[model samples]
Target: MSLLRAGIVGCGAIFPMHAASVAASGAARLVAVCDPDANKLESASQLYGCAGYDRLEEMLERERLDVLHLCTPHYLHPPQAILAAGCGIHVLTEKPMCIASADGEAMIEACRRHGVQLGVIFQNRYNPGARLIREALDDGSLGAIRGARCSVLWSRSDEYYAESGWRGTWSKEGGGVLINQSIHTLDLMRWFMDAEVSRVEAQLANRRHPGIEVEDTAEGLIAFDNGVNALFYVTTAYSHDAPVEIELHGEKGTAKLTADQAVVTYQDGTVISRDRLPQDAMDYGGGAKSYWGVSHFKQIQDFYRSVSRGEAPVIDGREALKTSRMIEAIYRAGRTREPVLL
Candidate 1:
C-alpha cells in the first residue's frame, strides 16, 4: 500500500502534534508545512524536514499531498479547507469546524461535491473512558440514558486572550469557552448519549475576560428526542483549570467520567472502571502543555486508514455537524434568552 502524503497548514502551538502524528502513523508521510509567518514556517520546516511555504496556494501547487490538516485559526478554516478539497485532498480541521453552521455546511458540501473526506478534530472522543461509555451504551449494558451533564471549568487569563489576538472575538475565535475550549466536551456528550438534540435553552456571559466580545462563560440545557435533558456548563473565568466532568443517568445504571477515569455501574450491583490516558496541553488552555493528549495520533492514524480504505472517518463533517448545530442553538438561545428548538 502507498503511504498517504500529509501536509500541515499552521505552525502554532498545536502544529507539532500533527507533525508528530504523521511521523507516528504508518499510513502517512509529512511532506510540507505552511503558515503566513516566515519565522514560524522556517522553524516548522527545520523541525519537520519538510518544505515550508508562506502561501497555501504555493503549498498546494508544489506538494503532492493526499491529506491537509487545517491547524489554522477558526476563521481561516472554511476557505483553506475548501481550497484543499477542491484540489482533491482530504481535509481535517481543528474543532468547531467553523464558527458558524452555514460555513461548516459549506465545507461539508464542497468536500462532498469533490469526493474527498472532510474530518473535524474532536480527539477527546477517542479516549478510553469515552470509548468505554460508548461501548456500554451500544451493547445495552447501560440500558437507557435518562439525562446527563458535561462541565468544563477552566481558566483563561487576560494574557491568554491578549496573546492570541483572534481569541475572544465573535467573528474570529467564535464564542469564548463554548466554542474554543468546551466543544470537545459537547461532542463527547452527544456521542455518549447517542441521540439527537431536540431543543436547547442557554445563557451566555462575557463576565470575566477583560477584552473580548465573545462570552467567557456559557451554560445550557439540551433536550434529546427521548426526553433526556442534559446540562452543559463551561467557563474560562475560573481561578484554576479543572478536569472536565461528564455523568449520565440511565434506567439500568449510570456512567461518570473525568479526564483520568471512567466508571459505570449497573443496577445489578456491578461496577466498571476504565483508566484513561492523561489529558495533556489542550486540557488546560494550551500554554505549556499543549501537546498533552495522545488521542491525536490515534485519530490521525484512523483518519488515514479510513481514507485509504475509502471509508468515512470516525469524526466526519456530518458527525461534527451534530455538535456544531447544538453550539449554534446554544448561542442563539443565549442571545435571545429563549429556548431554541433544534
Candidate 2:
C-alpha cells in the first residue's frame, strides 16, 4: 500500500518529534509542513525535504495530505482541526484537545461528519511505566483502585513565557501549568481509573509569576464515579523540571511511577518493576527532551494502523475529551471554591 501523506502545522519546539516520527514511520510520509514563521518553515522544509507554507489553508490546498498534525498553540487546535476535517483530512493533534469541552465536542463532531479520524497525542500512555501500570490494573493484578495522587513540579522562568508569545495567556495557551504541563498526568489518571469523573474541587494560583494571566500553580481533588478519588498538584515554580510522579493505591497493592520507571508492590509481598529502554534500544533519534518520553513514534504508528484499518485511533477526540472535561471542571472548581460536577 502507498504510504499516507502527512502534513504538520506549527514548526515550533514540538515540531521535530512529529516530523521525525512521520519521516520514520513506514505507513506515512512527511509531504508538507506549515508555519507562520518564515525561518522555522524554511529550516523544516530544508531539513525534511518537504514543502512548507506560511498559511495552513495554502498548505492544505497544495498538498494531498491524508493526515494533518496540529502542533500549533492550544487555542488554534479546534478551528484548525475543523478546517482539516472539512477537507476530508484526518487530524492528529497535540494534547488538551482544546481550551473548552464545547470546542472539543465540535471538533469531534466535525470529524465524524467528514468521515475522518481525529486522534489526540497523549504519547505518555505508551511509556513502559504507564503500560505496566495499565496492565496491572486491567488484569486485576492491582485489585480495586482506592485512590491516586500525581504531581508535576516543574519550573518555567519569566523568560520562558516572555519568549513564547502564547505561553502564559488564557486566550492562547489556555491555563498555565495545569493545562500546559500537567494535562498529560491528568489524562493518565483518568485513563488508569477507567471511570467517569463525578466532581472536582480545586484552587488555582499565580504564586511566583506576577504578570501572567493564568495560574502557575494548581491543586485539586477529583472524585470518580467508581468511588475512586484522585489528588493532583502542579506547579511551574520549582528550580528545575523535576520528573513527574504518580502513585496509585489499591486493595491489592500500590503502584508508583516516574517518567521512566514504575514499581508495583502487591499486598502478598510480590513486587514488579519496569524501566525505560535505553535511547539506542528505543531507536528514537529526535531531539525532544528526555522527560517527554519516546512514545510519540509509537502513538503515531498506532494512529496510522487505526486509519489503515478504518477505525478510530485509541486517543480519539471523545477519548481525549474525558481529560478535557476534567481540566475544565478543575478550572471551574478553582474559580468557585465549590465542587464542580463533570
Candidate 3:
C-alpha cells in the first residue's frame, strides 16, 4: 500500500518524537504540522520539511491526511480527535485520552460514527519490561496476580510550570503528575493485571510546587474487579527523575519491571531476565528521553497498519478510555477522600 499521509497537531515537546516516529514508520509520511504558536509551527515545518498551519481546521481542510496525531495538551485531545474524525481522518493521540471520561466517550463515538480508527499513545506498554511481564502473565508463568505496586518518582521544578501557560493549570493539564507523567505507568499496571478497575481510593497533594494548581504528589489504592488490588504513588516532588518501578506478586512467583529491564522468578526458582534492545539512533528525536522508552515508532507502525487494514488499533479510544476513566476516578477519590466505584 502507498504511504499514508500524516499530519501532527501541537508542536510541543512531544511533537518531535511523533514526527520522528512517523518518518521512521515506512507506512506514513509527514505532510503537515499544526500549532497555535507561529514559531513552533515554523520550526517544526522547517525541520520536517512539512507544511505548517496555525489553525487545526485549516490544516485539516488543506492537507489530505490519512492520519492525524494529537500531541497537544491533555484538554485538547478529545475535541481535536473529534474534529479529525469529522474530517474522516484516523486519529492517534497522546495519553490520558482527555481530561474527562465523558470527553473520552465522545471521542470514541465520533470515530466510530466516522468509521475511522482512533489510537492512543501508551508507549510504555511496548517497553521490553512491560512486554516481558505481559508475556509471562499470558502464558500463566506468572500465575494469578495477587497484588501489585508501582511508583513514579520523578521531579518537576517550579520553572517547569512557570514556563508553560497550561502545564500547571487544572483546566488545561487536567491534573498534575498523576495525569501527565505517571499515567503511562498506570496504564501499564492495568494492562499487566488484565482486569477492570472496580474501585479507587486516592489522595492528592502539592508537596513542593506551590504555584501550580494541580498536585505534585499523589498516592492511591486501586481495586480490580478480579479480587486483586494495586498500590500506586506518583510524585514530581523528588530531586530528580527516577526510572519507574513496578512489581507484581502472583501465585507462581513475581515480576519486577523498570523502564528497560524485567526480572521474573517462577515458583520453581527459575528466573528470567531481559533488557530492552538498543533503539535505532534515528528514532531519538529532540524530545526523546530515555524514560519515555524507544517504542513510539512501534505503536505508530501498528496504528498505521491497523488503519491500512481497516481495523482498530490495539490501543483504540475505547481501550484508552479505560485508563482515562480510572484517572477520573482517581481524581474524584483524591478530592473527596473516599473510595470511588468505577
Q: In lDDT terms, which candidate is top?
A: 2
lDDT of 1 by residue, 139-187 (tens): 9888888889999999988998999868888888878898889898888
lDDT of 2: 0.91
The RMSD of every model to the true structure, in order and in angstroms, is 2.5, 1.3, 1.2
> Lowest lDDT 10-mer window, candidate 1?
279-288
For each candidate in turn, the TM-score is 0.95, 0.97, 0.98
How many clashing pairs per prediction, in order? 4, 0, 0
In model 3, which regions exceed 4 Å deviation? 279-281
- Count backbone clashes in candidate 3: 0
Tens-digit lDDT track for model 3 on 47-67? Answer: 999999999999999998999
| Candidate lDDT (C-alpha), each | 0.88, 0.91, 0.91
What candidate 2 gets wrong by more than 4 Å, as runs, is: 279-287
Which stretch of 10 consecutive residues in model 3 shows the poorest summed lDDT?
278-287
Q: Any residue pairs clashing in model 2, and if so which?
A: none
Per-residue alpha-carbon lDDT of candidate 2 for residues 18-128, written as tens digits (9 for 90 to 100): 888898889999999999999999989998899989999999998979999999999999999999999999999998789999999999999999999999999989989
Stretches off by above 4 angstroms in model 1 are 277-291
